[model samples]
Target: MGLTVMMFTALGLCWGSNFIYMKLAADFTSPAQMTLLRVCCGFVPLVLVAWWRGALKRAQLRLLPHFLVMALLATAFYYFAIAKGTERLPSAVAGVLGGTIALFTTLASLVFLRSQRPSTAMLWGVLLGFAGVVVLIAPWQDGAAPLDKQGVFWMLGAAALFGGSYVYVCRFLAPHGLPALALVTWQMGLALVLLLLVTDTSGMGELLVHPRALAGVTFGLGFLGTGMAFLLYYALLERLGAVASAAATYLTPAVALVIGWANGEVVGPRELAAAGVILLGIALMQQGRDRSKVR
Candidate 1:
């Protein structure tokens, strides 16, 4: 396989495993506190990289507001909401639901951004993906909860913001000559500062009292998920263009499911079947898109 494919595959595996790590950490910390720590950990390395590459010196201070909004919406709000919602939802369910961000982004772009119109294949792909979600959740099952009614809605809401950020990045930032690594670095750095200001540090302090918990959150969120995965993603973008790079999102949930299963999370036959359908939908959607853009 090409370097791009390898990078994307690595990105998927790292990110998918992140859900389980986040779930584990969430058990020990409140969402805000967890978000704060994770952002801080992620930001530190990025800042070092930016400083080393002199990306920070070239950054326009006038664009601080734009970067701040993107940070708050994409990193801070997106993560806090997911963490909070996952308090009541299972990792498997959250992973499956989270996969809808791609579909949402496609629809959001067509409606709000006046970007690409949904082709027939894309429409069917979205529908199939959503149907797979419904099947995976099994709303009618005696013990199954309503997918849209629980705290999972917060995750969906987060995904919407995430999708919106993706559109914003593609539509506006990409045209302005912003490098993906620089953009992500600044976003996370700003988000870390903002989150630190408002979040109560009592929980964070308490978390440090437990070395294992701190290490788990730090390594998982910092090195593996945000740091390594994003570096690989940007590398893939440079090597393979955006379309192929963005396709990594399709693999994230699968990675999360495998990790969740290994951690003793139940993996039913229906869930596996739904995952297959979802993957099929993603394949169809990618098949219909212009392969030139990164998405």
Candidate 2:
């Protein structure tokens, strides 16, 4: 109803549709090439915003090491790994695995941050989330085509990075009370530089020839998904606080599944059930850690 709520909802859609965009672009570009395009396109708006808000500061250069760490953890590896993962998996299935971010985040918190003690509900959530993943992958079925193993692992790895980035932010970045935009700007900037140097971008330009994939890459995936998404995330962090904002994870996979279905990717009862279980697991994990923030 309210503006923030609307923004929150829109954020989920933007992220969810990213998979569809990737699927559209897959035929034209390699995973690194696609990620390079995304990172480059996404960087423009973020830098502009940081400048407009006066969030960019020269002194922040002192935090270069942290920025690079975040660059790898959040932007570089996160995007590329997910792209690699999605390359082999269906958009809907990849999106579901991406939901594992919450599970890993909770696990990271339990292991890395002693401030929050492990609770019974949290442990159960871990189990439920794992079981959901197993069901989603369906290793038992040998006759029919099972989910791609490599893709699933890549997605899981990306999810782990996603989950770990939150802890990295909580432990290292949050203490400074730096403007979130500034930190992200620096992180993404470095990631862009790193990706440009390493990625072979020769054929990358070919993807832009396709109108749909082009629009999706420049706008859907880049401007909205990367740049604006972080802008929205920081805004939500300010308004909703961390725990509540993180709940957006719940909406993202569902939106991705719906979009995937509409886009003609296979969506059956098994995926739906797995999604429900994963969501429930996330709910339980969050419940266990509620109001238990570090003092």
Candidate 3:
């Protein structure tokens, strides 16, 4: 349990930092290009780890389609939307919006999954969480708040995609008994291929010219954010159940808020209040769960 908690905490910090990295990398390249580079870079290390664990050969080819869908919805389109959104939205705002994955995941499970239904507490949580998201993006606030309608749409879309993918994995993939490392590796590989199919390498030379941007892409997006974070996340999912593992979403906003503030991003009272409400909603959502099985 202690190790699971530690892994969960570390995963939160890692994912929280990912928003800032996306912001940095977006400054240098297109969203599609950034997505392609991230998957390609993350793939190498993750694939190596999968190989070392002797998990790669154990993959069932019948499940390749599922892995491809996971890559598209969870990784490729998800990060592409984030990269584009963060170009207009602040990293902190992006993080808060991203954290709503728990809300969406819960709601999605209730609707699409036969085994998971929402309790009264879960319904209240859903309402509060949505309210918080609205408050966070209140265009009526102040002109100084830096709210972008298009960016909000993009982030919310990404969150929904991620949430749906979460339930999909829990329902379909989890029962298959595949090793998480190999599953993640295969997903990255498929995402790389999917991204390459749409995006070009025209910016490759330009990316090489900017050392700072290159570093952000290499270490921030590739090594820490994608590779290490996913590895930790899969470990937590296996140890703790999906709902419990999703608690990492709560921790990420705090880290992102601090990092964004430290980096000179504007965070007003409304943002803080909205974040608090979101956390409250998440807590309520967790309470509605059957935690005995999770533990």
- Give one digit per residue, the lDDT tens place, for model 1 in 231-257: 777778778788878888888778878
Each model's TM-score? 0.91, 0.96, 0.91
The pairs that clash in candidate 3 are: none
Residue 260 in candidate 1, Cα distance off native in Å: 0.9
- Give the Å error, residue 54, model 3: 2.0
Q: What is candidate 3's CA lDDT for residue 200?
A: 79
Supply every candidate's count of residue pairs whose N, Cα or C atoms clash at under 3 angstroms. 1, 0, 0
User: Could you list the CA RMSD of all candidates, in the order they appear?
Assistant: 2.6, 1.6, 2.4
Taking all chains together, the TM-score of candidate 1 against the true structure is 0.91
Judging by TM-score against the true structure, name the best candidate.
2
TM-score of model 3 relative to the true fold? 0.91
Of models 1 and 2, which has the larger lDDT?
2
Which pairs in model 2 have colliding backbones?
none
